[model samples]
Target chain A: MTSPPPPSGHIARNARLGIVLFVVYVIIYAGFVALAAFAPSVMAREIAGVNVAIVYGLALIVLALVLAIVYMLLCRDDADRAEDVAR
Target chain B: MTYHASSIAVAVFVFFVGIVLGISFYLGSRARSAKGYFAAHGQIGWFVNGVAFAGDYLSAASFLGICGMIAFYGYDGFLYSIGYLAGWIVALFVIAEPIKRLGKYTFADALNAKFNSRGIQVAAAISTLVVSVFYLIPQMVGAGALCTPLLGLPHWAGVVIVGVVVLMIVVTAGMVSTTWVQFIKGSLLVIFCAILTVAILARGFRVTADRASIKPVAATQPSDIPFGGQVVSIGNGDNAVGASTGPLGPVQFLQKINDVRVVQWTAKADAAHPGTTLYTPVEKQAREYMLPGGSSTFKGVRSPKLTDKLDFISLMIALFAGTASLPHILIRYYTVKDAVSARKSTVVGIASIGFFYILTLFLGLGAMTSGRLDPTPAGSNMAAPLLAKTFGELPFALISAIAFTTVLGTVSGLIMAASGAVAHDLMENVFKHHPNENAKVGAAKWTALCVGIVAMALGTLFKDFNVTFLVGWAFNVAASANLPALVMLLFWKRTTKSGITAAIWVGMLSSLAWLLLSGPAYVNIYKLDATRAIAPFSQPGLVTIPLGFIVLVIVSLMTREHAKPH
Candidate 1:
């Protein structure tokens, strides 16, 4: 039987990266939720006649775009570093 | 319940189902190899896969559940849209590329990629199957609901029809047919809903107080009609009553809401005639309510108090997180070619899904004031279609047919995902029972068959419950069980096989336990007094999601010294 292998150093480093990103995500989401549940007036001024709930609803639209850019940068850097280590 | 099966509606629905089947057959014949059967040989076009993502992701809850919620509950229902879309951020940023790179067929494959442990396989596959089936029930029920009106058939027929059609879709092309079907359904669902939304906005709110002008049949009496239910008396009086022509015919309504307050039918019994009930539309005089001012609009807009506010917020969190973490949606990453395509397709999916959700806001509110809300909670499902009926039978037929197809698209995607887990993940990898390409395809066929039966049984058992309500429980389960493990596995290198396995097990069991013992489940499903519910909070994401993370951290710490050296 093949012996079990340990996670590579790259994998370990990537894991750390993932933790930081996740914490960031939780903070952003919590902030958005607080604004939506509590700050309808700010939302109303931003979008006329729109409920805070609805504007907060649009937060996902903004979040998706931001997350896409972040993923590309972080994952590409990690992949490049892994290649360098291999060489 | 009335048999107004226009030949045009029947013809349109059958034609749609037929085209989907034809595509399935073509794809099935091509899916002879295991690679083809499991992942479409990773050859699916990015555009097609992207739309298929919408198809697979949308499901019955997105279509029927959200619409029903909006129609009945006002702005609260749209909160689901927010939650579901928000979850995708987690998917796109965190899981997509890594999932594409690591796994070949199922989510289990990716989890066990580094560990190569059989326990991980079993744990992950069990979660996949559990979540997939939980998701499938609502799709089947939605099919049954749509079929009753669209095809003028019974509930079970709709369930069977969807099951057989979906099974065929899976057995024929595997992912190929499933993907294309989803693409077509997804595109059409969004476009048509957009049209409906426009129609809704174009025709804004109208208030009327004509209490007796509108006439709705309350009950149908046995006249000379051959059907299950029919109208014997057509009385214009407010308390006129009727019975069904047969045992199961549509019971006509005398008093029904037609864009105003509740209408109550009062019947006075005559010595010879007994008493009869008639329809009377009630008028609601505007009463001043307090509006609390704040964020988007009303600085102090008068809305209901603390309980309503909490319920609304809870629902939004569930939708936002739920979308990113669904088992069915996560599994779609494997079918695409590479990471870039995965990200691109996700963007397309977000656009399509986001657009459709916005449309639901209109469709739902349209139904609310459509003045056609059925009094029973069960009838709430018909809000959108009934609203369409107010416009004309043609619009009603179109919406009903689209609703049926919505169920079909969602159910087909779910069955395909569940079958992949059985064929590719559990059977080949964990059990060490490798089948050839042909045999693997055979296994998938059988898996789809078994899963179809389970879905049907669930649909029938949940026949009385609202499909949307059941879906929220599914979202909670999905977010809790799968999200913790997936997130930890991708991000934490200290995540040992034991840690990952424990996270999944803890997440799955705790959420399931919370759901079973929660107040809502107790009152709605168990038929027991809600006060007996064991868990204080119903939504498990707040608790089980954190518990999963903690368990992983603790288990990893304990096993660190014994960890294998790199």
Candidate 2:
């Protein structure tokens, strides 16, 4: 923060990207939790072989990893692009 | 279930303890300065530190308590793992880079860096110590849990062993040793947990073919030794017997387990004895056993009662908020060299942690149907280890010992954070007694010793409850007390020193007060009636976390003009 801020568009892009991913994750996770809370029997329903809760739970965990990977790569690209613009 | 310590198991446990101590001593000579002692000279590799993140973050409660809960109750225990792992999102996105950039040594450093307020320093340091101590309780309780079956020693001995070993690790090499211990142990925890899960998949489910009556074991105390129930019948009918499944895949493991019936031990009020409990074996469908509302703790998830639903929601909030705010996890940011490395490590941590949590589903379900676990309500914490007992003694010993080191790693991180609070933050900063690096490290050693002793005493004092349940209290306090101040300071520009100070006190005290008066604590620790508890539920995060944010906002607005530029 002591340093000068990056170009406004660069910062905005990164912030918007980060916020979007975070919200996506929250909704994905919270949707599962909501299902568990309100309509647990729905969670108890079987898909293929696994229960809906198990399937949803596993998906959330896997989704978190994918999103983390996505964020890391995107942030690194943003940082590199900002550095290039400044140079 | 009572266990006799096999010579092989004891030998394995001893081997682990010695190896850990040896690593500590080897690292001791390297950490000479406060930077070396507290932050490992900021020379650690990003990947190793990332793995160390897994080690530091995944306490025994995750391994022992979650597995036990899943083993006993079903899918609800996995709920804790989900919340805990999801919290890393807050840490990775919001805290990791800024924390690395801001702090030189401690969490307090980053917090007070903006204004250099003695008030923020003192308050932040106190907050760190409180959170660390509260977190230490479950780790110590987990140490005892590992000791009982692995060594055949009493629970207190297990608590004392981790206390001493972790103290030596902290006093000797500080963060350098703690980080590596976490790194190695974290790696081992995941690897071995994978091995255990594979073993579970291979073994599948075995039905208890015979109906055996479990006799009264006299009046039960709350912390009574684990009780294993016999297989009364395999399926729904009394005639459904000899139902066995073999080498099932992950999905088949669950579906196949649905029809298997098992006897579970439950504690009931003794008709003859007023103040004592009677142990009774009850037969249950395995399908219901793996459902969300299986345990008394989570029965409210589907309960018609509003209080139960609120309790569930409150717990979820605490778990979500706790990770970003934890002093132990926050301090790990300093171990890496740069902000990028910090983020890298968090990603690695999330992946590693996420993988282990997935494995816990199989492990818990495995333990649930392992036919070895004591199906008593209280024995859920021992699920993973006892499940390991199904295969052989060697795996059980290794799992128990590794789980014990899980405690050791987390507790050492905690003690390091707490010692830094006293030695670096309180003494060097708040009091203006700027000791040289050597003196600071020496003071830290003494402080670590003191904190370790306190943790041992508290761990022994609190028993009879699952380690995960105790961890919920710690998470609530940390999220409520620490997260608001840190978040507002970083984002909300109006945050003033006075506001930070007031929020910390208000948040910390209110959560602690609510905890003491909550039903669980009143019934367990206070030896009083839980019904008399004034609070609506046990968890305080729902009310207190929001309160912290609101208080900081109001106070900061009032003091906005007084805020000086850095």
Candidate 3:
């Protein structure tokens, strides 16, 4: 017999979460790019012993990992619940 | 300025290649079936697959190009690091699970899963080959770049060496061996770069004496300098001072850099000589050196011209959208068991890749002040290796070997993707062949051999061309061609097979057309006046990516009534 397809409820829920997180990130990243392109002088200003350009660049890298982990955890819980309901 | 062949470097490089070949042979028996050859039988653990993502994604450009750019131009190179890492956010959050659930072997498998359209099979398979070949050229060029400095070999020998080694790896066990090779290289690259970063932090910066004496030389080429060619100089005249800042923390290093005066070089057409260029030194605050606009690549950001600003934005958008659409990266999702494994592995990839990008800032700045830069145009690609040489011969040897593996891992991945496109998508699906699993495997091996040879030839032919623009073209085309079709197919129920096919062809061709007729291509590739170019700017993503989405939407609406219900 053919195996059953994955529950659409779980898939839909995960896509929803993924889109929300992705939208959130795009806004933040757009801000970084805009500042560097249009208002570079502002990015050159020093803050906390480092320039804002360096600060914002490093923060974007860290924030990607942070959001990725959050999505993985949230999706894991949803997958587990869907599995239990299927059984 | 000169490279000598060292016995230690050769020994280390040989040992690395030997181990890679050994693993490929060891795994050769496990991949006899078609599934095993393409997707490792979906048996690889999430962790191995995750690091393999890092290995596959961080090509020679990420390691050597970014470091060299930063060594010469300061903070401008870090912009690439930021853009490259941010693309992973799109990959993990949006593309991972759907791709894993849909695809069995290749990216076309996922795009064709719903309709089983012959048109899609042809379009996507062709797109995969085009993107893969474009991406492969730079890695081959990188191999030549490394070989000249580390192994003292000619450019053609480097390309051939990498081509043959990757062929053996892919032809032996396909994805099974390719994944493991990527894993080992990824792990070693990260660990050693972390070690190098620590050394940079410990050494800190020192204000050295000015070395501004001009040596007169015969100037025949446009890039040849008439005078004043030092990479960096500190202070001027009697005010020059020599001091050391000892060991400083990462933040402290930036702050110290702002407090010094650094001399940077600018090239201009010589008034005295018609065809030759003159290099002149300009003194500026170290703070300006630590900011953007220090290099020509990023000078657009500070330019008042509207096209210049649009070009920068266009490139950033392409980079952000490209990573998720790459065929090699997409095919990697099938190596794991399920969608959950894909998600987890992507998280691991983002973590490893993100951390390495953060370290690039330190690596680049460290090379900037390392006082060992090669000032020639070719020397920019050698920044990281030359920096390692300053530490000692062993670090240099180890770093060079890791860099070589970097080329091997990326090239093998590209060949695997290309082979899958030919054997599985084109031969079986599009051409209506009824081959058994073993025959399919054999066909894929032959295809890999052919693709590897083609990559070597292109690498040797394009030896003198700037590889940076070739990589940018790959990203722009991949984003435009694949991203619109894949994203729309997954989300919009009205997306017709005709729409997907139309979008792929439009996106791919438009981006390619725009790149070839653009200003940069006019100057660099055609040897013509850039002002007369047809395209408004160099980068095409700002126009073409949106055009892909619009074409898909319009075509789907037009073909909606006749589409079969899923």
Q: lDDT winner among the candidates?
A: 3
Q: Which ten residues in a row have the lowest lDDT in candidate 1 chain B?
A: B248-257
Which residues of candidate 1, in runs, are more than 4 Å off?
Answer: A1-29, A35-47, A62-87, B1-3, B207-317
Worst 10 residues of 2 chain B by lDDT: B222-231
**Tens digits of per-residue lDDT for model 3 on B236-291?**
22333345667888888777766655544555566788866655556566677677
Worst 10 residues of 3 chain B by lDDT: B227-236
Report the C-alpha lDDT of model 1 over B1-566, residue by residue, as the tens digit: 24455666677788888888898898776677777777778887777887888888877777777776665554556666666776776676677767776788888888887778887888888888888898888788788777776777888998998888888888788877877888988987888777776665555443322434445534333221111111112122322332111111111110111112323222223344443323333322111000122111121122445433454455445555566667678767878877667767887787787777767766765575555555344555666777777677777777777777777777877887788878877898888998778888899889999999999988877776667767877877777777777777766667787787888889889988987887777876889987798876566666777788899889977876665733
Interface DockQ of each model: 0.19, 0.40, 0.50
What is the CAPRI rating of model 1's predicted complex?
Answer: incorrect
**TM per prediction:** 0.81, 0.93, 0.93
Error of 3 at B359 (Å): 1.2
* Residue B489 in model 2: lDDT: 78
Q: What's the CA error at residue A75 for candidate 3, in Å?
A: 1.5
